[model samples]
Target: MDGSITGHRPRAAAPVGADGLAARRGEAVERAALPAARRPGTAGSESDTPAANALDGMPRQRTARAAAATPTALSAGTVANATAPVPSALSADPAAASGAPAPSAAPARARRPGSPAARAAQAVGRLLPTPFGTPFTFGYALVLTVTSYVAGHADPAVVRALHQASSTDVAHLVRYPVAVLFASALWIVGGILSPYAAGFLLVLTALERRIGGVRAAGVFLLGHVVATLATEVPVGLAVWAGHLPGSSLHRFDYGISFGVAASVGALAGLLSPWLRWPLLALFGSVLAEGLILLDDPMTNWGHLLALALGVATWPLVRRAARARAAAPTAAAA
Candidate 1:
């Protein structure tokens, strides 16, 4: 060998064990397979490993699909819940849940007979009896028509005698108290035609319904007797005082006008405000006219007096009605 080192010569050095050689080879293969970014001591290389990348990519792909499908599924569930009816069993009533009877299952308390409901029922029942549900009213009209017809056909002497007997004069009151009953209802002028039949039917029937037949009759009689006495007494006193001729005692006076006026007055109390006011106004105007005109002094005065008596009877009428309403309830108890 020349000392000038003309050719580079290989030098055989230390020999390695089999185990060490195999370990070195395995390390080299692992390093070659790894990416540069994943090599040790590289920034963020811990997260860039193939196993970590695969784990992260698998979850992200699955989550994206889940998110996209979630809104559609949520919307469908919401619509289903909104449109679906709740089951009756699920909507339990508090009472039923507590083992108590439901309100609909419980028996209703019995109503007292005199209660407003009972009165209404009774009134309905009464209404079913007649067209206007007032038999007395019809009877009165029938009687008037028959009597009028009889008077029309009777002899002149007999008709005159009937008029005399039926006169409501103060001179006849003491001796013929019975005359008071018949006198006030008789029509002396045109017979039944002198009185308004329609007015009588309507007024009397309405009064009877509102205050019952008994009270209605009381009101009529009270008006008739009081008005007649009131008018006749003044005339009697005037005649005795010589202010008028004695002929005033025999003044022919007979009609149902006074009773009609009183009935209207009593009805005013029972009527609602709307009807009451108009009725009072109308009656008041008529009375005022009579007073101003002074055409038939006695009759006008009787009408006015009768109206006053009717107004006075309001307390009694109201009390009776209340008692009637309460009677059924009291009886039930």
Candidate 2:
């Protein structure tokens, strides 16, 4: 009987109190001393990956599919960094933007009539648009205002000479096209209180707010130049053909009415359909009524032409309005 009792009760069990605690504590100490790679969450885990399994003599080909499906830490990280979403407000409310007032950040209060916003809304025309954004209006209006005062006080002869020099008459345009074309727009022939002057201030400011200063200026200039040529060219042609008298070439033709008409037309494009049609009808009625007496048929016809030209710019002004609306806050400018 070569028998050695198989296991003599598996060495007496460790005591619950002293030796057991010491042994468990030592095991933890040994584990803590091991290198990081051998620790949980460290690299080179004995995973089911082919690369890891290859160490145990599996085929290298075994890892191809796994490698593709589960990106390695290094490659996956490269992709993650490249594809990470940019940080954003993650909010749909417009109040979250930098320039906008954040919701619930301020105490709840009623809007007061005395507040700056309310006062700004109530400001009269000409000053309606903020100066910084509407440079064309600011500089041009200042120049016009000064000129109006000078022209009112200057000798009759001098005022006549200046207007003659700036008039888009056939003779002046032939002699100095650039000078008269630009100078003609720099006056309010009826003074600043004229209906056309008021129209200029109101229409242009509204236009500047919607489509910006540059665009407003463009619309105005387009109208002024087109209408001037339209009305003057016919006279020039008639004179050359001996139909109009030579005195027709010296005809006085200057005003901001053309530009105002155009701005009104462009502004109409940015209005709602309800407002658009009414505005056109009212403006058209005023223009048509101006011809009832037929005292200045050519001039009245030019006004109608300029207004039509403005109405034609609907597509352009609408695009600008849409662009401004896309901004988080398109203040005046």
Candidate 3:
């Protein structure tokens, strides 16, 4: 009975070798893990080791899956602690970490004085609209008036010689010659000639620049000739019929100023939409002077004739302008 009992006890304990060892090891592990498990930091944790070390040796997939199973509150700290090894290299170059080059310092800009832009600005300043708002055409018309005074005093033969000249010669010498010969003559006389010439040159120069010198001269002559014929033919016929007493002998005695003035007057009307006031002022002055002061020596016919010629020539001028605009485009193509 003692042998049987001893043998049964050993056999029962024999079954507990490797399996028993494993069971004991597991029990010892649980006992060893008991302190960490019971610890305040790890209390109630299924894992005996801290989360960091448990994940260290684990397969990445299982670790990620386990991490995903954790609440979001724990996930943030877990992810931060996991990536703690990566911050040192990133801090070396913030730009490199962002995958871009560091910006270089910008170079300083250079300044230029007396440049073309400066010159253009200066020119614009000079050409700025004036407070008095005198149109350039008024000044040029005054030049024609001065020219009239010169041609008025010229010997009748000299007037005829000038009038009889070829159109080519007349056109070539018209404005400048009259300005120089007649306008300067008035200046030398120390009258209102300086203002007249200044006004004339300013207006004519601006007009010529705008329309081109050749075209401006042509328009000036065209208006002038039209006015002259209108003014002179009537006066001449009246004189020949003996209804009026003077200047059948010479149309130039009043000078060609009327024609020039008419040309300028026409240009003024064309350029300025606000022509009514100016034209009225001009005609009113003549009427007032004729009535009150100078007894109306000047005729309004020339101005009217000029306006008519200008209005008539508008179609031609518009065609020319269109042609000029088309020229560059045609050439480019």
lDDT: worst 10-residue window of model 3 = 181-190
Ranking by lDDT: 2, 1, 3
Q: lDDT by residue for model 3 over 1-333, one digit each (tens)?
A: 655555344233234477766776555434333334442224465543567345432222223344345354253566678734443464777775665666677876777579898899977644432323333444444655564565568797884565433111222233334442232222211223543344345544544544545565676666555554464556656766888766343322233344344345445544656864575467546534544553223245554555456556655655665676688799999
- Sliding window of 10 residues with minimal summed lDDT for model 2: 56-65
Candidate 2 global TM-score: 0.63
Q: Which stretches of candidate 3 lie above 4 Å from their native place? A: 1-196, 246-248, 251-256, 269-299, 318-333
lDDT of 2 by residue, 1-333 (tens): 578776557465445677767775555444344444553223564444545644532222313344345433235456767754334476666554443555576787876568787667677533554578677776777888887887898998999988888899999989999889999887897887788876776778888988888899999999999998999999999999999999999988887888888888989988899999999999999999988879777888888999999999999899988897777465645
Candidate 1, residue 51: lDDT: 66
Clashes of 3: 2
- Work out candidate 2's RMSD over C-alphas: 14.9
Better of 2 and 3 by TM-score: 2
Candidate 3: C-alpha RMSD to true structure equals 14.5
Tell me which of candidates 1 and 3 scores higher on TM-score. Answer: 1
Model 1 TM-score, 2 decimals: 0.57
Off by over 4 Å in 1: 1-135, 186-189, 194-196, 326-333
RMSD of each: 18.3, 14.9, 14.5
